[model samples]
Target chain A: MNFLSRLFGKKNIMTDITIIGTGNMARGLAARAIAGGNSVQILAHGDKAKADALAAEFTGQVSTGVLGDAVTGSIVIPAVYFDAAKEIVARYGDGLDGKVYVDITNPVDFSTFEGLSVPAGSSAAEELQKATGAKVVKAFNTTFAATLGEGQVAGQKLDVLVAGDDEAAVAAVAAFASAAGLTPIVVGPLRRARQLEQTGFLNILLSANEQLPQFQWNSALSFVPAA
Target chain B: MNFLSRLFGKKNIMTDITIIGTGNMARGLAARAIAGGNSVQILAHGDKAKADALAAEFTGQVSTGVLGDAVTGSIVIPAVYFDAAKEIVARYGDGLDGKVYVDITNPVDFSTFEGLSVPAGSSAAEELQKATGAKVVKAFNTTFAATLGEGQVAGQKLDVLVAGDDEAAVAAVAAFASAAGLTPIVVGPLRRARQLEQTGFLNILLSANEQLPQFQWNSALSFVPAA
Candidate 1:
């Protein structure tokens, strides 16, 4: 056992999370990961300066690298758009084997925001899973970037709707969510990602809607338990 | 405008709603409409006895009739499945020109439960709107029949998400929802029904999942305001 583990009596282990992309989602996730006491790595696509800037905001063991470099974490989160997320997985290839891949892409067709870009009966997470052998978990797609930045909407903690075919992988993600001060609701298998993506699209549509003034980008999707 | 209106004043004006089908959803909606002080008519397709039985359960101004009979209400709610809802709309034709149509169909392929049965970029509400020139509003699809029976789940009022292209039609449905003691969240136009149906399908998928013990059929989807 390591000295830290022996001294603490409990396993003093820190989860290592690699976040791909340096966008708003990437920064939100990195903030949560750092707050959860996990080590985070920022990977920038073509722009190393962006990753470095994001990493500089954190004090913990945060690292920066360019895409295609060797991923150093067991749980890799792709916070990029749908197409980029797929490309990242394809480019990583066998490197993601056995690793828990967190997919936060909404897969919405921005051109119209009317429908999903994914093919019928498939989701971005499922597509990522098909591209690589990683344990892909669909999460954070339903949450807005602004909500994730604050980790809560209004006074309620954000509900992270997670879906994955692998139970252990889902539990790992759930643990990460709980540690990050978010509520994790594991809806179902990876196939449920299709629904999650749809709901996420709906949430985004509501946020963009001018009619619903109260539903800003800071709004969230939550499943309230019956009283 | 009429003798009834003169007798009861503005407060005495109760909306007359014609609900097609005598199924669980039909009964549940009828119960709510009655409790909300609205006159409800039950329309049965090829089965008058079922509609009669449902109408008999309510002491309020509830009536029963055949499907093709003249719908005697400003708001006509099709509580049947997607296919049947379409058929009803097609049969009604121009008779539904100015009336408000409430579409409660989910249009989910229950056999697979993987996706919606509606065509790409279309929804059951949208298809129904195309069939007739009636003002179509999408609501009550997300609320389960049992939950609708009580009009609230776990002490929290059920959120009836209303989506329609007609502002007046949406307002009428919203008024009905408020009278029924439920919160009405008008998402957007009829096109937004696409997302509502997707979220309904997702809710069903979660309810059917044996792995998610907490996601019982009684669970309600709510957008809790941040404190």
Candidate 2:
């Protein structure tokens, strides 16, 4: 079921992005990557069928492989949960070095639904950066997977809040977002991911809130820039 | 120099809102309250002239007084910093009991510019609520004072995120926000203020960022609702 674009023994076609996991986020981000004229490689969680199914839906625009197979994209995104994201980094290890690793996970502590699961003053992106030399950039964490398909909420473009210490990495993510027809708002260093996660958490809370019927999972925390 | 609304012996006309401090926030919020058809009272910090000057700008639409004077509004907003907000609550004591006290402070730890100045689990609103019997509602903290004047960002209505344990207090703040030509997004109980504070802090960081010139102080962290 693992359909290799090039022969396993031959040089594979490099992709603009490698998305780990075959979930909604994976599908959503892959859509954006394709729309942005960027090729994608899907590294599914051992479910070759699921990966193949999604790849077929994308009209064979993406290369499909299992998680352990070599990641063939310059930009790697684990469209998985925070814990799983950490595991992916550990699995890839030094292989991710010099690659743009985008951390879109919001580590929410659902135990109390009180705060984030990450430790104080640090963010998921920063922690993921610690696991490898990957240029970790925090983007799309503030954006819901549902909204990424349309690339907007309401009539406004989705504000992709990017945070990373690596300038090249941040710019790379921003370029992709802009190419996808989304507005990328660079929110300073990786530490700012702490705030971005909170912003995302607040959005989730509002969406899940029965009291706030207006705010849904598809809502966008759009930063309306001054004219 | 305390320009009492009425003499110490006479009955004063109660206002719909009382705002402490004559800073930018005070002026901005006063604009909203008046636009909403709500009368305001300004309680300045021993600066009767400053209070009088602002009250004059409102063209006698608001009453003026120095701090320690009796609060006359059903809803009182301390349009001051986090530290000064606590001081105002302490100065008022049980007099604020049964009133709607709105906490609009972010409490950022400027020394590190890292996380919030508040403790790990608590927020400015929750802390302020504990200090007084006043029903503390968190609103306008996520909004910059500059936007209140025009009441919109990029032609969209300003989103007022309100949070509080007291449904009545929360409702009251929402009502005010709605009347002021803004969208009042109730983001759950006062506990959610923790995230709201983080949201506000993030907005501040984005604004102060010299690199992201688009995200200025006049910009907005708008939660664009799903259609």
Candidate 3:
């Protein structure tokens, strides 16, 4: 079936997953969603021209628009940095209520990578959820945009850590990852976003280290539980 | 040569690695040291009897003493929790000067697992270093005691992340890990211990989740950088 048909496929697949922002992460998530056989709607935070340019690069059922333009997807993934994601959430207001929002922000202080930008004992996902009162699931924050686009790291399948209070929303995000052929580990409740963010920030710190050339921006965190 | 000979081998191996506290972590680290062909000196926080019992369980040159005893090893690894490590550091005072102190405490708020016991912008290792001008190397905090004792995780060589500001101290810890057949990734300076502690705490949270039975106390964090 075509991307359009698969998006609303025989199983009554949900609406197009709306993506806000036109950047590396946005492009990467869009590619993953399409790879999972779901249509994608890309909404640029600003400058529709960039969104249009990014969408044009992809094949199948994909659409693009400016941020304030209506969000068409049942699941919304703001694949931007922490501050931009917050701004998008603020602009959307109650519009994002009930929407399956996915937060993939590290919120680390880029200048020093010493600490997270979000308040202590809290995470970007938690703060954004509190701001919009949306069903926010923290996923893909640990995966590099390049790895997400490539769908693997060092010849191994990538594991996406998912955390959210809403069960169905968590399952939905898990399913999205599964459909894309990535293993989804449901870490725990939304509070786990704090750990997930820290983990991501840790990877960021390692990536920034010039001494360790192997741990480039693409280092992936893998945890293997006992069989 | 025997463990004692290896401790001061013909190459001038070095002093026995001193491990403080008689907990599972102490046993794990001591076992690792013996596995690396080095003698071990364990100092119990309060009960020398407990330290004696634990030392008696080992197969090689191992000694036991109370907390106030002179630390024999140039490298000291406190396997106690965060607070006890601090108390031990305080008691040791300038004695720990120039020592390669290994901090394994996660500093997690076990009461809720919602936050860390260490203050913002600091880690358990960083705090302990400030307490005693000891050259602290943050290592083994990411590995479970059981897995460390076993020397491998799920049939794979465990990747021990080593972070510290001291070059020789970091190399000492890395050599210790390497002698035990584990891969040591020198992440960065000691400040990066903040991330290492968070990584360990995240593992704890996952281990506590009933839904994830596989991620029991034995769950291991393994990261493979690009070749």
Each prediction's DockQ against the real complex = 0.55, 0.82, 0.64
lDDT of 1 by residue, B63-122 (tens): 677899788778999899999988887888898899999999899887877788988878
Sorting all predicted structures by DockQ, with the top scorer first, yields 2, 3, 1
lDDT (tens digit, per residue) of candidate 3 on B5-85? 556642343456999988888988998998998777888988999999998888977877789887878889989888888
The segments of candidate 3 whose C-alpha lies over 4 angstroms from its true place after superposition are: A1-14, B1-14, B46-49
Which 10 successive residues of model 2 chain A have the least lDDT summed? A1-10
Residue A77, model 1: lDDT of 94
Model 3, docking class = medium
lDDT of each: 0.85, 0.87, 0.84
Cα shift from native, residue B23, model 2 (Å): 1.2
Local accuracy of candidate 3 as per-residue lDDT tens digits, A103-136: 9999988776678888887889889988996799
Docking class of 1: medium
Q: Using Cα atoms with residue i matched to residue i, what is each candidate's TM-score against the true structure?
A: 0.87, 0.95, 0.90
Candidate 2 regions off by >4 Å? A1-11, B1-11
lDDT of 2 at A111: 85
lDDT of 2 by residue, B1-227 (tens): 13554455212567799999999899989999999999888989998899888888775458888899988899999999999989989988998999999999999988988778888878999899889999999999978888998888888889999999998889999999999999998888899998999999999988888987887789887877787
Candidate 2 docking DockQ: 0.82
